[model samples]
Target: MDQKLPTIKEIAKRLNISVSTVSRALHNHPRIGLRTKMQVQKLAEELHYEPNTLAISFKQKKWFTIGVILPELNEQFFSQAISGIEDVATAQNYTVLIGQSHDSMERERMLVEAFRKHRVDGIVLSMAKNTDDYQHLEVLDKYNIPLVYFDRIPKGGQALSVSSNIRSGAEQAVRYLLEKGHKRIALLKGPDSLIASAQRQEGYTSALKQHGLQLDPDLIKEIDLSPEGTRAALTQLLALPQRPTAILCFNDYVCFDAIQAARQAKIRINKDISFVSFANLPICNFLDVPPLASVEQHPYRQGQLAAEMLLDIVEKRKTITDIKPVILDTELRIF
Candidate 1:
C-alpha cells in the first residue's frame, strides 16, 4: 500500500501550531520567527513533505504554464517554431503545453477549451488552416487569458500577432521567375479560408500586373495541402492550353507534393518547369530535386516573438489593451 503524504496540516498538528503559521514558516515569510521557520523546515524534511503546487497555483491564480496550439507538429516549420517557444519558456521557468489541431476547426476548438480549463497563464496559437470561425479564440478573451498568434493569424491585425510579410515574399518569388524568362507562372495556393493564401494571391496578381502580364485565372489553383489535393491541382495546371513554365507553391511541403506529381507525369524539374515556395524548411535541401528557390519566413523568429509578446501580457510587463502586430520581412532563399 502507498503511504499517506504529509501536509501543512499534519505539520501544524504535530508542532501544536496553527496551519497558517506552518504555511508561512515553510515559505520563510518575514512574519515567521527564525525558530519556527527552522522547526517547520526540519519537520518538512523529516516527513518527506512536498508543497502542493496545485494549491499554491490556485491561491496565486498564476499557473506559470502556457498553451501552444499548432496546425501540425510534424511540419518542419511548426517543429522549428515550437523549439523556439520551448527555449523561451524554459528560460523563464514556464511550462509549455502543446496540442496539434491537424488543420481541423473542431480539434482547435477542443484544444482551446482544454487549455482554458487547465488554467494556463496564456496561450500562443497558429490558427488551423480551416479555422474560419473565431469563437474559440474569442472565448480566451472572455476568460481573461491573453493570446498571441503566430504565422497563421486571423484576417485582421486587431489582435497581437507575429508573422512574416508573405505578400512581399510571394511577389519576390514571382519576380524571380519572371526574371528567369518564365512569363506563364502558376500558383498552387492553400485553402481560401487562410489569410496567408489570400496574401499570396494578392502578391501573385500584383507581380503579374507590374510586369504588364494579365492575371491568368485558370493558372491559379487552390489546394487543401493534401497530397491528393496537390496532385490534382498540379495536374490541372499542367493541362492548361498554355501551361505555366514556372510555379509558386504555398510552402515547401506543397512544393514537395507538386514536384513528385510532375515527375511522375514525366516532367523534368527545374528544366521543363521551375518551382518556388514559402516556409523555406531545411528538408528542401535534402530533396533529390528541391524547389528552385524558397521564401524564408523565419518561423523560429516568429515563434519567439509571439511567445515573448504573450508572456509579456501574462506577466503584466506589457498591456494587452492595444494590438501590436510584428511582421518580419522575408527573403528569397535560392537553392
Candidate 2:
C-alpha cells in the first residue's frame, strides 16, 4: 500500500510545535522567526506537502480572483477579448470569473452584487446597453473593489477604463465614403443611451461639418443593435424623400442587414449605394458584396489593457488616480 501524504498536523507533531506555529512558518510569517520558518519549509518540502489555496485565501481574506462582466459572450470580438484577458490573468497568476448580463440592467446589477459577495479583488466590466443607473456599482466602491471598464463604458463613473477611439473610427468610415464621391450619407446608429453610439454620432456630425455640409436629422436613424432592428432602420432610411447615396452602419451586423436591404431594393453596392461600417469581421470577405470600408477597433488590445489595469489595482501596484482612460486607435480598412 502507498504511504499517505503527511498533513500539517503530522508535521507539527513531528516538530513538537503547535499547528499554528507550523502554519505560520509555512507562510513565512515574520513573527515566526526566520530559523523556525526555514526548518518548517524544509521539512514540508521533504514530505512533499502542498498548501491548500482555499485555506491560504481564507486566512489572508483574499480570493485572488477578478470578475469580468460583459453584455454577451457570443460574439467573435468578445471571444477574442476574453482570450486577451486570459493571457494577462494567467501571466499574473490570478483567476478570472465571468458573468454575462445579456444586455439587461437587472442582470448586470445582480452579477455585480454577486461578485461583491464573493469578495473578488477587482472587476473588468463592459456596461449593458440599457443600463442607466449606476448605484449598484457604488457597492463595489464601498467594498474597496477596484473596477476597470472596457468597450462599452459608463457615462460617468469613478472606475478607470480602457476602450477604442470610437469617434476616430466613425470619422474614418465617414471620410472614406465622402472620398468615394458619396454625398447624402446616412447613419444607422445604435441606441441613444449607449455611450459608444453617442461618440459615433459626434464623429459623424464633426466630419460632415468639416466638409461644410449641413447635418440632416432625417438622414440619421437610431435603432437597437440587432439584425432585425438594422433591417427595419434601413428600410425607413431608404424610403425617405431624399434617400442617401451611401450608408454608415453602427457595426458589422448592421452593415450585413443594410447590404441585404439594398440588394432587396435592387440597389447596386459601390455603384448605386456605397456602404461603410465599424467592425472588420472576417465574414465580410466571404460576402457576395462587402462594405466599401470598415473600422478595426482592436477589441483584443482593449481586453488586455483592461485586465492589466484591474490586476494593477488588485496588487496595490497602482491606484485609480494613477491610471488614465486608455484609448487605442482604430483604422479604416477600405475595400
Candidate 3:
C-alpha cells in the first residue's frame, strides 16, 4: 500500500492549532513567535512533510521552471552551452526542462507548444537547422512568456538573442588561409536556410574581394550538415578542374566529415588540402589532425547570456523593448 502523505491540516490537528497558524508558523511569519515556528517545523520534519509545489506555483503565479531547446545535445558545442545554462538557472533557484529538436522544424514547434502548455516561466532556444517559420515562437506573446535565442537564432534583430559574429569570423578565417599563400580556397557552408551560413558567405566574399580576387560561386558548396551531405560536398569540390588548396568548413563537425572523406580519397590532409572551421570545440584536440584553425564562437558564454536575458524578462527586471541583441565577437584559434 502507498503511504499517506502528511499535510498542513494534519500538522495543525496534531498540534491542536488552526491550519492558518500552522501555515504561518511553517513559513516563519514575523507574527508567529519563534517558539511556535520551531515547534511546527520540528513536527513537520518528523512527519516528512513536503510542500506541494503545484499549490505554491498557483499562489505565486509562476512555475519557477524554464524550458531549454536545442538542435542536438550530443554535439560538443551544444553540450557545453547546456552546462552554462544550467549553472545560471541553478543560481536563481529555477528548474530547467530540456528538449532536443533533432534539427526538425516540426519537433521544434511541438516542443514549444508543450512547454507553453506546461506554463514555464520562460524559454531559451537554439533554433533547428530547418526552422524558417516564427508563428510558433510568436505565440508566446499571447501568454506573455519570455524567450531568448542563442547561437542559431532567427534572421532578425527584433528578437532577444545572443549569438557570435560569424561574418567577421569567416572573414578572418579566409584571410588567415590567404596569408598562408592559398589562393584557390573552397568553402563548405551549411544550408542556405541558416542565417549563419549567409553571414559566412558574405565574409568569405568580402575577404576575396579585398585580396583582388573575384568571388567564384563554383568554389562554394552547401551541405545539410549531415555526414553524408558533407562527404558528397567534398567529393564535388575535389572533382573541380582546379582543386582547392584549402577549405573553410561550416564548423568543426563538418570539417571532421570532410577530412574523413578526403582521407578515403587518398588526399593528404593539411598538405593537399588544409582546412579551417568555426566553433573551436574542445573535441578538436582529440583528433589526429584537426582543422588548421577554428573560429571561436563562445557557445557557453552565449548560453549564459541567453539564459540571463530570458530570466530578466520573466522576473520583470527588464522589458522586451529595453533589451538589445547581444552579438559576441569571434576569434580565430590556430591549432
Compare the candidates by TM-score and give the number of the best one: 3
- Per-candidate Cα lDDT values, in order, are 0.93, 0.87, 0.94
Flag regions of model 2 displaced more than 4 Å: 1-6, 9-48
Tell me which residue pairs clash in candidate 3.
none
TM-score of each: 0.89, 0.88, 0.93
Expressed as tens digits, the lDDT of each residue in 107-189 for candidate 2 is 99999999989988888998888888889986687899988999888885345988888899988888878877877999988
Tens-place lDDT per residue, model 3, 32-83, is 9998899999999999999989998999899999999999999999999999
**What is the RMSD of candidate 3?**
2.0
Comparing 1 with 2 on lDDT, the higher-scoring candidate is: 1
lDDT of 1: 0.93
Better of 1 and 3 by TM-score: 3
**RMSD of candidates 1 onward, in order:** 2.8, 3.3, 2.0
Candidate 2 backbone collisions, by pair: none
Q: How do the candidates rank by lDDT, highest first?
A: 3, 1, 2
Instruction: Give the range of the ten consecutive residues with the poorest summed lDDT in model 3.
Output: 150-159
TM-score of predicted structure 1: 0.89
